[model samples]
Target chain A: MSVAQATRPPKAPAGLTHAELNALRADFPMMSAQTNGRPLVYLDSAVTAQKPQVMIDAATRFYEREYASVHRGVYSLSQHATDLFEQARAKVADALGAGKDETIFVRGTTEAINLVAQSYGRSVLKAGDEILLTQMEHHSNIVPWQLVAEQTGARVIAAPITDDGEIDLDSFERLLTGRTRIVAFTHVSNVLGTVNPVRQMTRMAHRRGAVVLVDGAQAIQHLNVDVKELECDFYAVSAHKHFGPAGIGALYARRSILDAMPPYHGGGAMIRSVDFGGSTYLDGPARFEAGTPHIAGAIGWAASIDYLETLDRQRIAAHEADLLGYARDRLSEVENLRVLGNPSERVGAVSFFMSNAHPHDVGTVLDQRGIAVRAGHHCCQPLMKRFGLPATVRASVALYNMRDEIDALIDGLHEVNEVFG
Target chain B: MSDLRELYQEVILDHNRRPRNFGELEPPCSEADGHNPLCGDQIRVYVRIVDGKIEKVMFQGSGCAISKASASMMTDALTGKSVQDAAKLFEGFQAMVTSDMDATVGDEMGKLAVFAGVREFPARIKCASLAWHTLQAALKGAHEMVSTE
Candidate 1:
């Protein structure tokens, strides 16, 4: 077969049948709950994953009896809280295969990117420099660079994604030059669910002597992410995206690079000494995190990670693969229902649109049925424009999702087509 | 709600496909544009008022189902309404999205009643109220409704 004829859609794996998948729905306690008396089919995880009971209880337990302000005080409770807070950070560092000196906790991925942007982007970058990115990045990845560009006189340039939703390696190579300071892009596209080759991208950036920042907001939940293997200079992920709480995130920057960069914010916990002449700053992550940290949120996030660790990573990945493959196959039954991405093994997500039906209308009807799927641009407005679509409806899957849920989604698409046809 | 599916209802599919009054008025009699940069919703409302009465009202924009359908329903309901009466009606619709509406406000804003369900969705209240807010701005002689953030 020729190259044109060689590429075809992959067949669904036979690991989990719809019946078996339906039976396994009890794994998630929330799946048993109802919304307006309808079964809750949550498929908007790219926005933020729903928390498991373990993470919930971690926060609840802390608030109930063990609550105390961390990192400041002589009380025994304060010391315990501080240890838990630091222990969570140490766990986060271990999660990313990084040292404690390399990880800094902020509000979320947006703040993490902003921290690096305001610190390294402003201080080190200069005019004529370019921060390279792919066209398929979320606005969170794009906007932070734009801010730094506006401040430092450096420019923001985009690498193109092929029509099939994978990044164009030729285009990426063309975009990079001596002035390329940082290569920032999403590890996975929120809409298309295309998992980019981070290792290869980092290697390409390294060849050009530029650092890379992978927006792993989607990856950590689906894939086994290791920063050492990826060799990215700065990686960002929102805790909420990985079954954790909102309002807290982690940024992994190489210690050598962070050592040269100054602190972005100034406040309590970040100071070493304060004199009339000048003030000295704390080192490493403490210097970057310059406020009263989210102690409860950190503890809760660690608990979420703990919950995921109880399950087999390989099993979760396989189950998601089965659901995604089955969903893709089932949706193809519709006349004009076209699945967006063409990944060999998709990261358990599907994005598409019907013949004449707008995604917003589809989303509303889905909401009425108590099926929560994200609709519209998925925060990649430029990608939507490139695809010549106003928006798309996306149903992203997690470990808790099953094939029957995917069937519900496919059947819903059929109803949408019948109504609109 | 009967079918556990993510399909748009017949009513929504019809509104989305046809999208009543889905064009800009050439040299619009009175026009105002509003955009929700948060969700990338852009809408422009046009009104041809004669003698303090809205002789004609129409809209053209790109947005979610609630915003577009609400705008279409807005024009259909407010076509020949007196500007003063329409203002009160707009307030009723606003109350539906922003607060609770009494029977008086409810009956007065007929057909627009379809969007009463929007109140349950706090994040989507803005989607249902975008056109009404623009109408309010247009009546006040404002030119545009950009991000108020």
Candidate 2:
């Protein structure tokens, strides 16, 4: 079949029946939302996934029925709340094939990376040490390392990506020297959707005695990520990137590595004993988690994981891959529009720019049509600089997204072209 | 071709396609950079004022069609006006773009009334005003970058 004919109306592979996917879509109330006079076509899941009704209900139930602070009170409500909160940590660990003690609940991937850099990085890295990173890392992954490197007198070196945006494996391996103390990179690029071979890269880094931290913020939502299988020393994921509440995420680190790191934040709950001389700290996970955590957010995150457990992940991934291919094919047909990367394996996100229209203009026009997209640097200014672009318009897919939404996005781009022309 | 068309008027598109006074001025120019971090719109405004009148105005940066067009139209409107007059016009243009739809757009604003449609898009007001803010900074002889947060 001709390219246009094949891509114009893309079809999902026969995974879950149409009714099943529709029922799943029905779980998100925002699916029926509108802007101006058009139905909402949410193509910005990379920014934040729309929470499902289960997540809302879970958080509401915690507040309405099981409302209390965790880990401190002798009261029954507090005890119950504590159990559920800790259970949430277990759910995050289970999702990543990690032990409960290996996971520390934090506030999103940004905070998670900061915790690692400040605690683990400061403890291990010394003067003249090197922290190697990939070119496609989000600002969250890059900035934290830079801060830690500055403090420890270490330097951050970036391994380059190929022209099509895949991690240059040879360059990455070469960059892993004796002085390389840490190797941090994104599991999947937020802007390009390029899925790095985390297993292979982690092994390579480990061979050179460098600790690897995979920023799995963009990976866990769309792909089945197992930190154990990847064999990375640390992995960070945000619950909000999936169908969970905001302000909560998880960091998975090896038990040995966590045991060696110091406490990142000094506050209540992270200490075991207080004395005038000094304070004794708690164990690994507890050592990192200070202050009262987001209790409701954790419960809601567990609920999201529970909801994900009901779906066939392989089937969902297949459907997402099909959507990505179809989107690339269809988007190519738009005149003067350039889809940013042609990675061998891309996931949910696609960044593109129309030659005649700036990303902000395109984003504004799309918003008017009730099609939401992320525009600008997407918290990846370094990557934008690598591509010689100031910004791009990004449309990211989720499990609930349908081919109709892609059609709507294509229609919105046509409108943008008309307006700009 | 409704509210959107109003926002992206032919005049605005024309200015975007061929922005006027879009280059750097040599030394002896008062210049300031403006940034709207939300959309990554960056603009540098350069002015050569003589006897308090804007003898020449130019802008060099990359941004959206609205931002580039707004910068282009702003330079054209303020080139021959005094610094105080330019500030007044900037205030009027800002009010016209951000205020109520029925807010007055006096003939003093001239071609800048096209940005009145920005009132409908609250997020784009910064895009339409970056160059103007930079212009204000230039007039004040401020060296720090101006940001429309």
Candidate 3:
């Protein structure tokens, strides 16, 4: 561990245990599934986490029993719909340690990022302004700024990631200036799995008079994120990356900043009134959420929050830490296969390139044995270019993944070596 | 080894290790780059045609086991074959990848028979046909094309 990691807060919060994690997995029906007759060992949680039965049931029940357009109709059912929608918002806000007014619902992390880019970026950013981002960001975080920069003639600057996969805070400090509008990067890298020091980075950005936006798609489910504690001005997350249903995410902005930004998409729900002269937009969050939001998905997302509550999430984090450590130890034993970004504080993500065998062959071979792992660039093409590889095989874990699965993965790695031999 | 056998065959790994018919050809002929950015597979097929007959066919670039193997197989299959004949071969091989029946592709694909098994793995269709597609584009006389990204 580096000096920075040694001083950084421990990976997980206090007070979590094993009985808790097992119960958490029991809540998810997918945990009990079999793919090709073998238990479905899903290790692609960085892409999307498995949905729990409770969240699924919550979504289905909403459609089956309480189906109505919210905030529109004056009927009893519509009122019920509106109440459920707002309650879900409140639940998510509580989960993220944010206020309801600060959270704006969108489709997923991608849309959440586009929301910030179009609203805050387009409206506030002027020519010669700079948007600072880390090289470890997913394309979602990197591209939106590019789009805004292209449109506004603003320059997008990159903060370098050190060889160990952590962001070079010195490089970040150098990139900062009065003209740096936004510093948007991932809270935890999806490919590298390095948990960034969000609090420290946010404070740094704040001192430089810049708003920081964190792509929490990878971190929201894994960490106990307190946006208030981090003092992050804008935080983006996708529900699917957590244990919730797909197509639901939230962009949490400090109330003042969200109020300052313009509406992203022009639509019916977002407008207070429309006349020939111009349309008056609704206040703050409603201004950001233009179309009909993910109503059922939001309700299900709330159920996911409820399900996460059952397991002390801190314990789940610790259990994953142990599994991650065990996996790292086992995988490192494999000859000629070097794990990418073996950070002192890595989340449950392992990206590695075989010395002789290409990653596609490795992924295919793994798939043949009923073990599924993501192959290729993992959507970080720039990161691929940084590492000077076309792609890599990635295995990411979640709360439900067990020690035996790690054994299976180790066996699979050896299987790859044997095949190549 | 037998079950882990089909997908990562010795021939596939061999091509991945020492890709046949590799390296770029100078311009003045047709060329198309096939890229699968998802898997990070890249291939460039360069063609030399004389009187509508492909007198010389060579390919260059790096990719995964399936792609490199498929490229070597295609180059070996089409070296003496004409542009028209190569197009037909490309069509037949594409059916093997896109079509649901594995036997149809396996039986028809002569030297490209190794890729027939890739038909079973649908996600790898891009990998199997990356070289074949570049060949088709080259035959159609498209130039400086980059794909797969």
Could you say which candidate leads in lDDT?
2
Backbone clashes in model 1, listed as residue pairs: A412-B6
User: TM-scores for chain A, candidates in order?
Assistant: 0.94, 0.96, 0.95
Which residue segments of model 3 deviate by more than 4 Å?
A: A1-22, B1-4, B105-108, B144-149
DockQ for each model: 0.38, 0.82, 0.73
Per residue, candidate 1 scores C-alpha lDDT tens digits across B1-149 of 53322223345445656778778766548788888765677889888888988888778888876677778878888888899889888888888766653333357667666666665566677877888888777777789574523
Tens digits of per-residue lDDT for model 1 on A375-410? 878888988887877788899998788767787787
- Give the range of the ten consecutive residues with the poorest summed lDDT in model 1 chain B: B2-11
lDDT of candidate 3 over A255-311, digit per residue (tens):
988888888899878888999999999996888777788899999999989988877
Every model: Cα RMSD to truth: 4.4, 4.0, 2.5
Worst 10-residue lDDT window, candidate 1 chain A: A1-10
Q: Where in model 2 is the C-alpha error above 4 Å?
A: A1-13
The lDDT values for all models are 0.79, 0.89, 0.82
Q: Against the true structure, whose TM-score is highest?
A: 2
- A best-first ranking of the candidates according to their TM-score comes to 2, 3, 1
Q: lDDT score of model 2? A: 0.89
- TM-scores for every predicted model: 0.89, 0.97, 0.95
Docking class of 2: high
